[model samples]
Target: MTRSRAQTRLMLAILGAVFAFLYVPISVLFALSFNEGGLPTAWTGFSTKWYGELLRNADIMGAAWNSLIVAVASTVIATVLGTLLAIGIEMRRRKGRLVETLVFAPMIIPDIVLAIALLSMFSLAGVRMGLHTIIVSHVVFNLAFVCAVVRARLRSFDWSIVEASTDLGAPATVTLRRVILPSLLPAVIAGALLAFTLSIDEFIIAFFTAGAGRSSITLPMQIFAMIRFGVTPEINALATIVMTLSLVMLAISQRLNRGSLPGQ
Candidate 1:
């Protein structure tokens, strides 16, 4: 009993240390975001002026709007393509190793390498680099994530229902719309949310593809530019807001994913 108690204490200590290491800096940033002084080194009283400043900053708002557009467009495209790809792969009786590898390549590849490759591809194709390029880049990055999530859900799917529907004289489109899609709705939404979160947070790919202007700059790129000058209270406030949004989306995605699992 004494040894078990000691082990439990050690585990709790380790857990506490891990949490502190991960969150202490974020906690500091969060606190400083509300500081009236707007300085990281010293805290004056609490105030919401920094957040107000963020709202008023045209550059920040424009970048935020750009990010929203990229995220929404990429998530929609990735979700649709990924879902179709997942269904296609799952429907196949012989799932080849090469095909699996290709499907997972985007997720496995380093972000920097993927970003460079995408940039090169766009250049070679003579594509105009702008918000549209960023949207396309994000779609590429997010597609694998969406596919993986939907594929996991599909693993436990009851395909017998689909077969039964087909036997009942339903057309392919009818069966897909009325049967398969309804069952996969939760997972699809979860995948879309997850994709949106990834697209919003993605910086390297967006940066490479965004090309030559403030017009295509995303929120992460803007944050990077601002932090190069120094971490001000406005940056802190912006970070806090972005982090909160990401956490909320991730939490919802996780909940939906859990609920979609068999016998959950």
Candidate 2:
């Protein structure tokens, strides 16, 4: 009994240490965002001035709007294309390993490598780098993610119903609309939310594809520019807000992917 108690205590200690390592810095940053003095090491008092400052900053607001545009556009495109691709792959009986690898290559590739590759491809194609370019790049990155999510849901899908619908003389379009799509709706929405979160937080690909202009600058790029000087309270506030939004989206996506409603 003593030995088992000692082992349990050790496991708990390790778990506590892991949690502290992961969240202590984030907790400190969250706390400092409300610090009136705006110093990392010193806490004068609690204030929401930093959040207000973030709202008042024109550059931050512009970058945020740009990010919103890119994320929404990319998520929409990726969700549609990825869903179709997922359905195509899942419906095939003789799925080749090569085809699967090609489809999921983006998810496997390192972000920096993919970003540089995209930049090179754009340059070779003589494509102008702008918000449009960022949107395309994000679609490329997010496509694999959306496909993976939807494909997981498809694995457990009831294909017999689809066959029955088709056997009933339903056309391909009608069968897909009435049968497959409705069943995949939750997964599709989950994938879209996940893709939106990724596109919003993504920095390397957006940075490379965004080109040289304030007009195309995204929130992550703007945050990078600010942090180059040093971390400020305003930056902390912005980070907190972004992190919270991402967590919320991810939580919702997970719930939907599990085919459950929130608070259920």
Candidate 3:
């Protein structure tokens, strides 16, 4: 009984410390966001003025639009390709090490390496750098993530049902449309949300490939620029909201995927 109680106390202490470490900074930022004086030591009163100012900021709005466009386009493209790639790779019993390496290279390779490589390739090919370029570059990494998520869902998926559907005289297209898609929809959705979140948060690659303009600036790029001007209550509000949204979406994605990832 003593050992159990001691262990319980130790676990609670660790958990409490972990939570405080993770949330204290965020709590401070949130409190500062509402401070009427915008000073850490002084709190005149709570106010929503920073959020209102953010709404009125044209530069932030424009950059947000660009980020949305890049995120949506990349997510759509990655979802389709990743889903198909997951199915294709799974169909192969013996995955060549090269194929595995190539498929996952974008995820493992350093961001600067991929960024520079894309820049060089684009310059070499005379591809105009723009939002489209950013979208295309995003897919290189986003697709790998989406593929991994979907592949996990497919890991324990029974193929016998597919065989049965085929034996029942359903054509390949019909079976895929009616049988495969239904089982795969949840995983596909989880992967897509994950992709969208990544595309939205991506910075280094977008910064290099965005081709030097505030016109193609993404939210993270905008936030980075704003940070150079010193942190403001407005930025704190924006950061908090962005972080909250990312965390919520990721939480939902994890819920859908559950313990299926990593072959567990």
- Judging by lDDT, tell me the better candidate of 2 and 3: 2
Residue-wise lDDT of candidate 2 within 90-200, one digit each (tens)?
999999999999999999999999999999999999999999999999999999999999998888887899999988999999988989999999999999999999999
Please report the candidate that would top lDDT against the real structure: 2
> Each prediction's TM-score against the native?
0.97, 0.96, 0.93
Q: Write the per-residue lDDT of candidate 1 for residues 221-241, one digit (tens) a residue.
A: 999999998888899999999
Tell me the tens digit of each residue's lDDT in model 3 across 119-222. Answer: 99999999999999999999998999999998898897888999999999999889888988788888888999999999989999999899777879999999
Candidate 1 weakest ten by summed lDDT = 255-264
Runs off by more than 4 Å, candidate 3: 1-4, 259-264
The true-versus-predicted C-alpha distance at residue 220 of model 2, in Å, is: 0.5
- Model 1 residue runs over 4 Å out of place are 261-263
lDDT of each: 0.93, 0.95, 0.90
Give the runs in model 2 whose Cα sits over 4 Å from its true position.
Answer: 259-264
Clashing residue pairs, candidate 3?
A: none
Task: Score candidate 1 by lDDT.
Answer: 0.93
Better of 1 and 2 by TM-score: 1
